[model samples]
Target: MNLDFPTVMLIAAVITGMIWALDAWLWAPARREVAARKTASGGVSKADLKELNKEPVLVEYARSFFPIIIIVLVLRSFLVEPFRIPSGSMIPTLMVGDFILVNKFVYGIRLPVINKKIIDMGKPQRGDVAVFRYPKDPSVDYIKRVVGLPGDRIGYFNKTIYVNGKPVPQEIIGPYFQDEHPLSQSAELRIERLGNGEHQIVVEPGASLVEGQYIVPEGHYFMMGDNRDRSNDSRFWGVVPEENLVGKAFMVWMSWQWDQGGVIWDRIGESIQ
Candidate 1:
């Protein structure tokens, strides 16, 4: 099953919080009062009092984990959340199995499941690697680099990007090769100078270019994967609505490859562009 983690967290927090609240406000007070009356009426056995005071297992677990679940819910919903890359569409920057940390509050804090933004903290930049709810399937979270802001004219011709009629500079760095990794033999690494900093992109030379011109609408952003000619992004579908944005991905916390058989420690703590 494709588990919706944020929804699951919200549900857990609510159920456990309600259980704790009920015990605190009604059940525990009633039990305490009953014990007090029994003690005053006669010599109530200590064992009888202990038995009355003992909490049910489910209630105990709920009480113990309520705080933890709430803390996780708040942190994940407003502060930061972790995501795992499952595809190579962002290869050379975000490899498959890369565990990334996204800054949630930087973009804005939204109500978890509903995802309605209550505050507007900042806007997405042209070069930000952002995570957002997929427009086609809101339940799916997609990661891509922000290529065009609202009201910008964007064009892709001959695998080169043009912003406002000017070509966004992309220079061929060289043929990119991973030592003994034969799967990525088809593409070359190129440096694309975006806003503030430059990042590497994988491009298949002589591959069929998916060219198009688009005018970004207000309240939306254009997105594209770093792997040119191999990405299913705005070029393939459509622009990402601002409301669907989740957060900006900033770092790779971990990378694991089970098929390749182990943790890739070298990619740990790597900063994402």
Candidate 2:
């Protein structure tokens, strides 16, 4: 079964917040009043009342974390959601272990859990690194760079990108670092200049070019990973429909290389362009 994390977070936040509020407003007040009455009647000593009136540690912790968790969940579902990079599909620009933030309402405002878009905000533009639900499997989310909008011709050949019968400019950068790993040694860095902006990309020169030409259909977009040689994107699966779009990734909040040990402090607060 595919677990819906946002739903789980929303439910947990509600349940915990309610429990905390109930304890604070109703149960705690009543308990304190009872203790005070007992003390006034001389049935309970001051020391005994003090001990009895103390809230449980678990309850105190729940009360504190409830509001914080609720705020985070709401912000994540409605404003921006944090996601960690799991693969090298967007290498050179977004490396594995990079934690990025996606703007939740960029494409449109959608109700959580139901995934029903209720507001029309804006369309995906060229050079955007977007996160979206996989068309083949709605439960799965995938990330890639937007290359073709609706009704545009997109072609990939010889490890180069062509849009609307014109080639997008790609300038070779220095050799990409391997980071003490065997798999990372295969790529070379290049910078792609799109209409909106410029970003880094990785390409494997000797790798076979999986060539294809696609005419983007209505309400759909053609997407490609920055790592041209190591990505399975629109060329392999298909174009992403408008409804499948989740959000536009706009920043890198954190990055941690587990093999290298500890947090990559430099990557924090870096804007995604």
Candidate 3:
């Protein structure tokens, strides 16, 4: 219902690849042989023979593109898949154009179209960045930092985060640059320490608390964006169910900013922390 562009592209690639394979292995070869025999006996004109030759053009293109599509689909559904940041939700850590790679099998390997989990690999760890289907709208994908696991109590007040009744430490680092949003014109860069992991985050002083305490239900997790002031995550829409878990975001493979034309080489190979 709420199918996004990526899902549609993947489906298209699969359908096209199947058609191509069928033609090559079953139909096209037979048709070609028939045409060849007709040509040898002078039963068909040159123009008709030319048209017959073009019958395999679609198959050829499909065969060529099948490998590329399969590679992407396998990587995206079972290994590591790349994604681009579209909003300021993960600002300090991931910019609007920052491209990231998510480890698809970290949680489990699921079939792409059906999204049915076929294996149990790992569970979400505290302080990990993750991608998942929006609980309210399954077709929409979202990325966020995992803060609370199942049965964990997460609290947010006065712009600070508290997990399991303990306060998470945050230290001011420096001023953050504003890009794509006017509200970020004067933001503070801060390092937030969660459990044993530390990550950079952006905060706006004197900003109101957008979310409050929540008890993460079983089989669900609480998530938040690094850009505390901008993300609409579990705090607003509710926890992400275990079934919605897609993958753990692990690295930035590439970045493309319309303002900056070609590849953003500097951001490449940067690990997701």
- How well is each residue in 58-132 modelled by candidate 1, as lDDT tens digits? 789999998998899899999999999988878789988899999999888899888999999999998999999
Overall local distance difference test of candidate 3: 0.85
Off by over 4 Å in 1: 1-3, 179-186
User: Against the true structure, whose TM-score is highest?
Assistant: 1
- Model 2 stretches astray by more than 4 angstroms: 17-66, 181-187
lDDT of each: 0.89, 0.86, 0.85
List TM-scores for all candidates, in order: 0.94, 0.81, 0.82
> Which candidate achieves the best lDDT against the true structure?
1
State the RMSD for candidate 1. Answer: 1.8
Q: Candidate 3, residues 1-273: lDDT per residue as tens digits?
A: 566545776886978888887997878888898889888888798889878767566777787787888777777778887788888799778877888888989898898878889999989999999999899988778999999999999999867899988889999988887544446556888999986699999888757658579999999999999989888988888899999998998889888777667677888998989
Better of 1 and 2 by lDDT: 1
Ranking by TM-score: 1, 3, 2
Worst 10-residue lDDT window, candidate 1: 177-186
In terms of lDDT, the poorest run of 10 residues in model 3 is 177-186
Give the distance in Å from residue 125's predicted Cα in candidate 2 to where it truly belongs.
0.9
